[model samples]
Target: MDVSGAGGLTDDRVLLGRTSTAERVADILRTRIAEGYFPPGARLSEESIGGALGVSRNTLREAFRLLTHERLLVHELNRGVFVRVLAVGDVDDIYRTRRLVECAVVRGLGQPPFAVDGLAAAVAEGEAAARADDWTGVSTANIHFHRELVALAGSARTDELMRGVLAELRLAFHVVDDPHALHEPYLRRNREILDALRAGERASAERLLARYLDDSRTRVAAAYAQAVDDPAGSAG
Candidate 1:
């Protein structure tokens, strides 16, 4: 409850409508988790959120169950649901998945003149966020960049899978003590990857993405472990 808890509910209301269903509620909550509106360990108050979204308690509960299954939320007996704080191993697994999916997406490009406009746009988004000193926005932009990168595969199934995986990754990001350290270093690298894709250098783009995922996995996993192990830290 020390985190935003239910206090962000008023602002969150506009995200949903009176016609909201469980999946829609789940999607909104997932986006909030990724955006850090509900940071790691923040207790979710059912009354607040349900009232804000104009959804029934059952629908809200269903959405909570969905995110719980995704490893993005947890329900404790006698205590309300809370945003999940990922373990260090979870961090490693996330990056490993990213490397596998994202790199493969790039490697599968059979020839040149790939449609990389989305990637370029995402890169520009990150650059603009960086210029505005919006670190969280940079992180969001990075998410967009990766989403665009994976979109090149033209697989709806892969897109949904990566969306869940990336949302889980953002849970780990919330546990990180320094957002800038977690995201700033990746902006130029995103542009580099975009450039490679633009030039039709599939292999080059794949390698760059692989290395980027490796470095990020190392940094985030270590920081996350430290945050979890240190009693004074707010890992969850």
Candidate 2:
């Protein structure tokens, strides 16, 4: 699953055109990071990745710089860049932002008979992934559900913001010891929110989302802290 080279980067969406090569590299790298292809604290090897993707060092460096600016990667002098490992404070702030933006999106919804087909599909996707024991897929489906929920507002800027935020959130998830325990409980909450939205109960959906994010933030932060505290844990 090393998604580098012709096999990985040559997809229609990932094609590197003559222009925007660096931007395309950034996009590809960003997606890979979000997908947990590169987990938290994973060192990105410029030489191997650049060679695999047929990009120059300059292009790869620029892409890394872009991701670093996004707070997804950190640069350490004499140590190279690695994926960011979130602190407890970072977790709280991320969820606070989520509660603000996600709840606001629900509250801003227009009247009844909402267009929530995408949300419903995402919920089904999570269920299917759970049935298949694909926890990663479940996490992805959860992200999709929230993305679809935000789409209710129809704002490109907000969509872009959540894309980054959720990607960061995924970094925290990548460090958890019990993926099933961390993610399984939330699938039901996703369904409940989706049902509420479909029923045109915006306030109820927003409240559910607020509680969900708050609870998720607390759970994820505690798990991450425990991992960091336990030397044998995989926080690295």
The lDDT per prediction is: 0.85, 0.82
Per-residue lDDT over 155-214 for candidate 2, one digit per residue giving the tens place of the 0 to 100 score? 989987887888888888887777888889899999999889888898998889999998
CA lDDT of 50 in candidate 1?
A: 84
Candidate 2 lands at a TM-score of: 0.88
Worst lDDT window (10 residues) for model 1? Answer: 1-10
Task: Please give me the total number of clashing residue pairs in predicted model 1.
Answer: 0
Alpha-carbon RMSD, each predicted model = 2.7, 3.1
How big is the positional error of residue 160 in model 2, measured in Å on the Cα after superposition? 1.4
Q: What tens-digit string does per-residue lDDT give for candidate 1 at 1-236? A: 64434546667667676677898888888877876788888899888788777889999999999999989899989988988877778889999889889988998987889998898888999999989989888998898899888999999999888888988998887676777877888999999998887888888988899999999888888878988788377532
